[model samples]
Target chain A: MEIKENKKDAVLLLELKGRLDASTSPKFQKKILSVIEGGEKNLVIDFSDLDYISSAGLRVLLLGAKKLQSVDGKIVLACLADHVKEVFDIAGFSVIFPFYDATEDAIKSFE
Target chain B: MHPSELIETNLYREKERTLFYGFIWSAVFLLPKTVAVVLSNSVVLLADLLKSISKCIASLASWLSIRRVAKGKDFSYNFGYGKLENLTSLVLAGVLIISLLVIGYEVYHRFLHPEHIHDFGVWFGLLIVAAKFVIDVYFWHHDRHLAKIDNSPIMVSHWKFYRADAIANGVVILSLIISVVFKNISGIKYVDPIGSIIIAGFLLSSAYGIVSKSLYDLLDGTLEESLQLVILRELAAFFDDYKEFHGIRSRRSGSHLFIDIFLEFDNEKKMGEIYQTIEKIRRRIEKSIPGSNVTITPTRIPFV
Candidate 1:
């Protein structure tokens, strides 16, 4: 998977591409963890090009969400594919992660 | 919202309306039919009355199941109430089988000792049959049209009931005509019993079909071969991503498919990268088979 990071003030916007599975989640997780360690609070993951996500990927997101919660930080998801949204729904992750239709909305929410 | 989702919502509302109307119509007609059976002393009419009763029960059960399923998953029921449809089907099948046996026994007894017609009100029987025919035809057409679009098992089952009732009404009318026309024939008395047997046979076969289908679902049967092929094709495309992958298991619940796969990736690869690869494969599988819940487990060694 490909992840492009854009820093907007205190928020970190990540545009992801390709698949987020067992093989790619570790890299994605490390990237997010490093950003969190750098004291970035608000996170927005843009799933406009993301085609898939499995349980392993979900776990990474959950971990990130929990980590952010500990530091009074927040993570929002945007532009999810229908199937990917369904996965979040089935796994009951929708309640844990707030979803926005666009990255701008996600960034605005962090304010 | 997508157009398809809007259409689906409309269709679901329409289905609920149709089922509610059908249940009300069946109950409204059931009382008079039961009275007719008591007054006419016709085995065919009695069988028809039993069938109507069973249909009403099945309709109510199906409606209840649909309502329960609509409530979605709860703390008590994690998988939702989709299985209620299968459970209702099983109960309906059991009722049908029992009704079939009762009708069959009545037919057999009538063959041994035929009784003289006391109050064989042909006009009364015809009136009840005609009313039933109208109701069955209306619901049958409506249910069939909806079933074609939704293809829900409960809707299909309701359609079967209506179709069988319409056919059974025709048989009852035919038996009535034969008994009335050939009043002098010694075997004319067997017409109604023979009609009951035919109706019983129809019920038995339909019940068998329902029982087998519901039982298969209850047992957690695998998805259709075509769907399994789609999953396999998706997996085949990602063969190089992992060193070895096995233990692909799948089952269907309602309209959703649940898939479990185990993969052994290169040991040197980072965990996040491994997750990304698995996610890609999951996306491919989900695209090929929509509305599937997938679980991917990473293993160090292949299971022997």
Candidate 2:
């Protein structure tokens, strides 16, 4: 998994791609943990190109969200592919992490 | 994180099933031989059969121990069940030693009574020893292959058991050969019991080694000094900016290593860069420590 980070308007935009299973989830977790510990405050995860995710992947997201919340920051998932979106919905993660259709909307919400 | 808490992976279910099959085969080979010896009322054959029966039980225990040891860390076991594997090794060693002692005592009784054994009893004992030798060799090779690929202590112990079985069988064959060579010698009948005593001594020493080592690990003794120095040096070398360290602790269960260290860095380092440094160090430490769980903590200390 590759995390491409961009900063604009005091919000961090992270592009995520590839399958997030047990083998790859740790890398994703480390990336997200680094982002949270870096004090980015607002995190916008763009999942437009992500293909699949397992329950372990979901645990990483939850772990990241908890870390972000500890610092009074918010984690938003944007551009969820339909299948990824379904997984989030099924897991009730959509209720825990606010989702947006585009990175621009998530950034605007942060503002 | 506690050492056991970091154990996230385990052997697959297929491996567990294979161990079960191996244990069953071992028992199958021992039962008929044991029954034959008891029916014939031959002390030599009876004692050998009893030893095989104990080996069968220890084999079953080995299977159970592997299953239990491969389990992930639970709330009751903060560091995982790796120690269970060590305990199993000790249990196996203890069982082998106890069997040897019992057989030794029986052999001593036979030495006092001096009874003549039938030719069929001798032939049956020889056949069983030959069969057991072949099986033990097969198991040893299989266990060695698995241990090479997986680095499992349980597999290593199993391999050692096979080696020990081969030695015991060789003793049996040697004693039989001696009886044939000295058929006219009046005092030659005591060779089998004397061989039993020697084999018992061999088992006692090996058991002491296994039990002592496992007990030390169960008590959380420091790992090999060289391994500790190598890990510490690897961390320092991988992260050049890390000037000092403290709270370095490590313990090993089976082949897996659990390492905890507090890495000192310059106080003014940005948290992001610091985290990146720590991440890199964690990766390097893991690479250096095979099958390792590494936790690196960033701490600020004066440059010295």
lDDT per residue (tens digit) for residues B95-188 in model 2? 8777877887788898898655555666667787788788778877877777665556667766676677678778876876676567578977
- Model 1: per-residue Cα lDDT over A18-81, one tens digit each: 9998689889978987998899889999999999987657756765765576578878999999
Give candidate 2 misplaced runs (Cα > 4 Å).
A1-111, B1-15, B39-47, B69-76, B300-304
What's the true lDDT of residue B64 in model 1? 72
Tens digits of per-residue lDDT, candidate 1, B1-304, equal 8996687567667767777787788798887887777777788888888887888888887777776665554788755465677788888998898788888877888889885443456667778889889889988888988877665667778888888889888888888778777878877898878888888978988898888877877778766555654665565456457755434667655545688877777778899999999999888887767657788889854332
Candidates 1 onward: DockQ, in order? 0.02, 0.01
Tens digits of per-residue lDDT, candidate 2, A1-111, equal 777889987899888888887689778877877877777788888888888876557756765664565567878888888888877665556667888898899889987
Give candidate 2's fnat, 2 decimals: 0.00
Global fold similarity of model 1 (TM-score): 0.62
Report the number of backbone clashes for model 1: 26
Chain B alone, model 1: TM-score?
0.80
